[model samples]
Target: MTRTLYLFGSAAPPVFDVARVIEDAQSGGWDVCLGLTPTAADWLGEGLDGLAALTGHPVRSSYKRPGDPDVWPAADAVLVAPATFNTINAWALGLTDRFIVGVVAEGIGKGIPLAVMPCVNAAYVQHRAFERSVRELREMGVTVLYGEGGFVPNLPGQGRKEAYPWDLALTAMDDLVPKREA
Candidate 1:
């Protein structure tokens, strides 16, 4: 059976390229559903409709009211690409003030496999909370693609949008699923 992948995004600039990420996830045999942080949703602006079409689901940015039925299918995997510094810190603390964070917090509690690729600058990564968050999330069984082999930090004011390690996050998700021997 094909697995459902929830592609979550933050306000980082790279979240604009989420269509490409959706394509990648789809090519990997996953049915993609997207949820963006509020800021990221605003950033999408006119492009939001296109993304919704690509995923065949509404691009959700807020939580539905209580007593509302589930809008999307259960997620088999979750990828938070362009995960911002604030989002990282908030998610690490299990804060769920927004839709994306709520999904992340719930996903973790439900033991859903999660892979995150944070898009903060080099200086941002030096913040105590950033490192601590990465460690904390990892301990929670979230696959944080960071350090040498995963996401290499870029200098502040010199963001490398073209070079973000989207592949590694996908690979991490692939690693989460056990492969059947051919």
Candidate 2:
């Protein structure tokens, strides 16, 4: 049985390369469903359709209306890559204002295996909320690859977009819920 992976992205530089990441997830034997933060959707702009086509699922950035059928299949695992400072804090606090945050927050209660890799700078890391958020998420059984062997903070205004650990996040997701052979 093919496993479905919900890959959610925030408005970090790595989000620009989400199409390639989706392909990578697919190659790893997952049916990829893409979801993005509002800013990420806007940033993706014209490429949204292309990403949708690539994943064979709509790139959702908003919640469907009440009673509307879910477009994507049930997720066997969730990977939140390039999570921004705001995204991490909001998720840790259970603030579901954003579509991606909402699903991930609920995914926890539903017991869906989840992993997140935060893409933040050194300045953002100094914020007290950031550390608390990471701790909270980890306490909730969420695999947070924030430091060492995961995503280390770069200096502000000096982000190495190319260096974001998309592979590491994908690997963590695979570890959370590996695909089962038919």
Candidate 3:
């Protein structure tokens, strides 16, 4: 049985590498379904169709119409990489204005294994809410990789897109929900 991974992304510079990340997850035996925040979808405009094709499911950035049949299979695990400060705080505060945040917030109550790797800068990290939000998510049983061993914040205006640790999030997700033996 193939494991399904709901890979959701926020609008961070690292989101530009999401195609490669999806491929990596697929190689690791995950049937990936991609979801994006509204801004992230806008940022990936013109390439959204390509992402949908790559994931074998629609790249959802908005809530589906009520009563609409679900498009993707049930998720066995979820990874929200490049989670922005807004997304992290919004999720912790239960503010579900964005599709990705809404789903991941619900994933918590649904008891779905979830992990997040924040892509924030040092300036953003100084905000009081940022640390509180990370703690709240961790207290909620979410695997948040945001410190020394995971994604250390870079200086503002000095982000190293190439250095974003996508592997750390993937590895943590794999640990949380191991792939089933076929």
Candidate 4:
């Protein structure tokens, strides 16, 4: 069975070209489902439709009305790239204010494999709350790709979106949810 991966993006510099990640994951055999934070969705501008086309499902940013049918397939795993400080903290707090957060919170509860690559600046990583949140998520079985050997924080004004490791997120998801060989 082809594994479905829900790729969630936050409002960070790397999100603008997140399609590259989707394409690479597709090549790796993930049936990608795109979802974005509201800010990320707005930042995408006209690229939203193209992203929906790329993933073959609507890029959901808001919760659909109750009773609405789910358009995307059941996710076998989730990858949150460009996970901002707010998203990391919010998710840890179990805040389901947005569709992205809702999915993440539920994914955690359901024991769905999850990988998060935070794209925060160096200063934010030093915050006590952020540090605690990362540790808490790690305790909850989240594959947080942060710090050394993962996503190194960039300087405040010198974000190297080009260096963001989208591939690593997929690799972590693979570690969590092994693909079934046909």
List RMSD in Å for every model shown: 1.7, 0.7, 0.7, 0.9
Alpha-carbon lDDT, every model? 0.87, 0.93, 0.94, 0.90
What TM-score quantifies how close candidate 2 is to the native fold?
0.98
Encode model 4's per-residue lDDT on 86-173: one tens digit a residue.
Answer: 9999999998898998998998889998889999999998899999999989999898899776899888989978888877788888
TM-score of the candidate numbered 1?
A: 0.95
- Model 2 lDDT per residue over 118-162, tens place: 999999999999999999999999999988889999999999889
TM agreement with the true structure for every prediction: 0.95, 0.98, 0.98, 0.97
Q: Candidate 3: deviation at residue 24, Å?
A: 0.5
Which stretches of model 1 miss by more than 4 angstroms?
A: 178-182
Collision count for each candidate, in order: 0, 0, 0, 0
Model 3 whole-model lDDT (C-alpha atoms):
0.94
Tens-digit lDDT track of model 1 for 1-182 = 56788999999877877899899888887889999998888899899999989988888999998999877898888998889899999999989998888888898889899888889998998889999999999999898888887877889988868788888888888788643344
Tens digit per residue, CA lDDT, model 3, 1-182: 78999999999999999999999999999999999998999999999999999999999999999999999999999999889999999999999989889999999999999999999999999999999999999999999998988999999999988999999899998899888877
Query: Candidate 4, which segments miss by more than 4 Å at Cα?
Result: none
- How many Å off is the CA of 38 in candidate 1? 0.5
What candidate 3 gets wrong by more than 4 Å, as runs, is: none
RMSD (CA, Å), candidate 2 to true, equals 0.7
